[model samples]
Every structure is written in structure tokens, then in C-alpha cells.
Target: MAEGRSVSDMDVDDVIAMFPKIDPFLIRKWHYAFYTFFDLIGNNVIEWKDFQSLIDAIGAVRGEGSEDHVAAKVSLTKVWKSMTDTMKKDVEDEVKSTSSWKLHVHSSKPCDNRKTEKVLF
Candidate 1:
């Protein structure tokens, strides 16, 4: 399931199915938001690496002390500041709506000879 395609060629529903607990609506919303925010439509799909990049970026801010984390946070902060008011509001609203959501990040541990990383939400 992890091979044979570039990250931008991954199917949305397939990725969503990987995390059963997260609200599909929320995932879909973020999918579209990321799509727009990252300008990922050139290939018409969001790949696994893209999703991992998002998680890493968020984790850099949310995770504890590390030089890499600090650097990622600084980069994200600059991008966040550069975002338009509407874009910021959209993100704020999405976050507010999912404030009560249960999200969990799982490592890409190998299982059955395959590596699957899950960011549950």
C-alpha cells in the first residue's frame, strides 16, 4: 500500500481510511485546506510525504526541545504571519472546531514488512 506511486498521486480516501478514529469531515476539510494552502492541485492529489510534512511541521511546534524543532517553528511562524487574514481565519476556525477532537501521532514503525505512519485525529 505504500509503494508504486509518488506522494502527490496518493488517493485521499485511502489515506483517510488509514485512520479510523478521526472524523472524516475534519480530515476532508484539512485535505482541502492543505490542498489550497500548499497549492498541491497541480497533480490533483496530496501524497503521503505531503501529509508527513504537515505533521512534522506541526510537531516541530508542538513537540519539546530540539534545534530542528525550533527551526521548524521559526519557519512556520514566518509563513503563518505571511498568510492572509482570511486564510488565517479559516485555519483558526478549523482548529476551533476540532479543539475537542482526539488526535494521536503514531510512528512509522514497521509492520508486516511495511511501514505505516498514522496521525490520528
Candidate 2:
């Protein structure tokens, strides 16, 4: 890991080296998704506050009390709920570590029968 950075901040090469058994492509995808979406505040961990940032951003653009903003909050809240449900842990009580996130990504199977991995990017 980079100096002063958490394991979540490790580059692709470091991640690949750490989990050599996992596919490199899948590792890259998971890393990309982690940084792009989960680590919204760049803290290297997934927390409710990160999701709140996304909700706040949507509210800023759509107007705080507007329908769109309210809808975004509702939708994101549901997403958070589903994620916590899947993990069987409360996000508000504990942050999701990057290692656990990686495991979750690795364990998930492609939703369809297509040979290609889903293109998240």
C-alpha cells in the first residue's frame, strides 16, 4: 500500500499481487468500482456518510426539497439498505473495509449467461 494510504488505496498491481488467485481483470474492475462509487469521499472505506454525499450532490443539483431530490434519497436509502442486508451488517455501526468489499465483488456472479464480464466502466 502507498505510504499514509490504506489498503484500499493500493494500486492495481498491488491488489493483483495480494490476491493472486483472483482474476486480474476482475480485480481491476473491483478496484475501479470501489474508488469510483463506494469510496465517494475518498476515505478508502464504505460508510453511510459516503452515500449521504451522493444524496447531497443530487439534492444540490435538483433542489433540496424537490421531487427529484426526495426520490434520489429514497432510492439511495433503499440501495444502502439492500447492501447492508446482503452483508448482514449495519453500515451505520461499522464501515465496510476494502478487503471485505473485494471479497464481495469476487464472490458475486455475473447476472446473465454471457461470457463477458459486465462492463462497469
Candidate 3:
């Protein structure tokens, strides 16, 4: 498991496995949250950075320390490394491309695209 590797290649099951004590259903819900959040930038996958942030937030809420963070990172990284090279590249490219694109909303009159071409990224 590489420290700098992304976790986008890992599936929902692998990601949820990091939190052994948590309910898998709850983790799936969080995955959906990440999915919806990334949808804003045209990304359907949850990259390692996004998952790490979510994990960090949860750890903070639960008063978790560095040990938990380390363990989560290691678990996720192991899954990430198990992914194929092509999948890894695809995930990396998606993250870079989506993150680079900006969401620009233009509304001149009503809430319609007729007034202005809404470029929602």
C-alpha cells in the first residue's frame, strides 16, 4: 500500500471495510454522500482524498486519535494497491480532470437555460 496512492480504485466494500465496527449500511450511505458531493464536479467516484477527509471528520467527531487515522489510511491504501494499473490510472485521471473543471452558473432572467447557457461544469 503506497502512502500517496488514491483510493478511487477501491470499491465500496473495500472502503467500508476500513471501519470494521461501523455498520456497512451506514458506510454505504456515506459513500452515497460522497457520490453526490463529487457529482457537483462531474465525478462519480470517491477518491482517496475525499474518503480521507470524510474519515478524518468522523474521527474528529468520535474523538479518535492519530492511531485510528493511521489504521484507516493503511487499510484504504492496501485496497488501493490491490487495484489494477489501468483502474488506478483511470481514477487518477478522473480526479485530476474533474477537479480542474470549474462550475459556472449564469442566470440572466428566469431559472431556465434559455436566458443563458448554464455551464454547470
Candidate 4:
């Protein structure tokens, strides 16, 4: 791990060295996904505020107070809750660093088609 830098800040070789058991392709994919989806504020970590911003953006497009907006909020809230619960922490204190997020991704078995199908369904 690079001093004062998260895994997201590291190069491919650094990430591979940090997590040798994980696939390099998966790590690269995650690195892309993390920046593209999770890091809404351009920060290296994923926090509740980022999810709230996403929820707000979706609500704005769907129309706040509308059924679709409400449903989106509920669904996103559940997702946030699931993440925090998995880490055994409160929502306000929850912060998904690159290493922790990658570990969670690995534990979720992203390579398993059955699990992926279940999530998609």
C-alpha cells in the first residue's frame, strides 16, 4: 500500500501486490467502477453523503414525492444500510475506503454467475 494513498490512488502493480489472491482484471474493473460510480464527490472514499447525493439526483429526475422517487430512496437506503451493516457500523460513521470496499467486493463473490444473477434479479 502506498503511504497516505488509498488503493484507488495506486497503480495496477501496487494493487496486485497488496492483494495477490484477487484477480488483476477484477481489481482493474473495480478501480474503474469505484471512480465512475461510487466517488461522487471526487474523493477517494465512499461515504453516506455520496449516496445521499445520488439519491437526490435520482429523485430530482424522477420528481420528488413521486412514487418512483420514493421507491428509489427506499431501495438506495436499503443498499446503504446493507453496506453499513456488513461493516458493523453506523451510517454516519461509515466510510468505504478502497481497501475495505475491495474486500467487500471480493467477499460478495463477484465472479459467481449464480450470485450475480441473483442480485440482478
Q: Per-residue CA lDDT of candidate 1, range 1-121, in tens?
A: 6255554566566556656676777566656555554433244432333333654766767785467666665665444333322123342332211111112112212441121112111
TM-scores of all predicted structures: 0.33, 0.77, 0.33, 0.72
Candidate 1 residue spans exceeding 4 A from truth: 1-5, 40-77, 80-121
Clashes of each: 2, 0, 0, 0
| Residue-level error in angstroms, candidate 3, position 3 | 39
- Model with the higher TM-score, candidate 2 or 3: 2
The models' CA-based lDDT, in order, is 0.42, 0.70, 0.44, 0.70
Candidate 2, clashing residue pairs? Answer: none
Q: How close is candidate 2 to the true structure, as a TM-score?
A: 0.77
Model 1 TM-score, 2 decimals: 0.33
Model 3, residue 117: distance off in Å is 41
For candidate 3, the lDDT comes to 0.44
User: Which candidate leads the pack in TM-score?
Assistant: 2
Candidate 3 lDDT over 31-91, as tens digits, reads 5544564333334543556656756765787657677766766765543333213133443
Worst 10 residues of 2 by lDDT: 112-121
Error of 4 at 70 (Å): 1.0
2-112: candidate 4 lDDT, tens digit per residue: 558665567766766778898988777776776777678767787888778888888899888789888878987876776666556688874577666666667764454
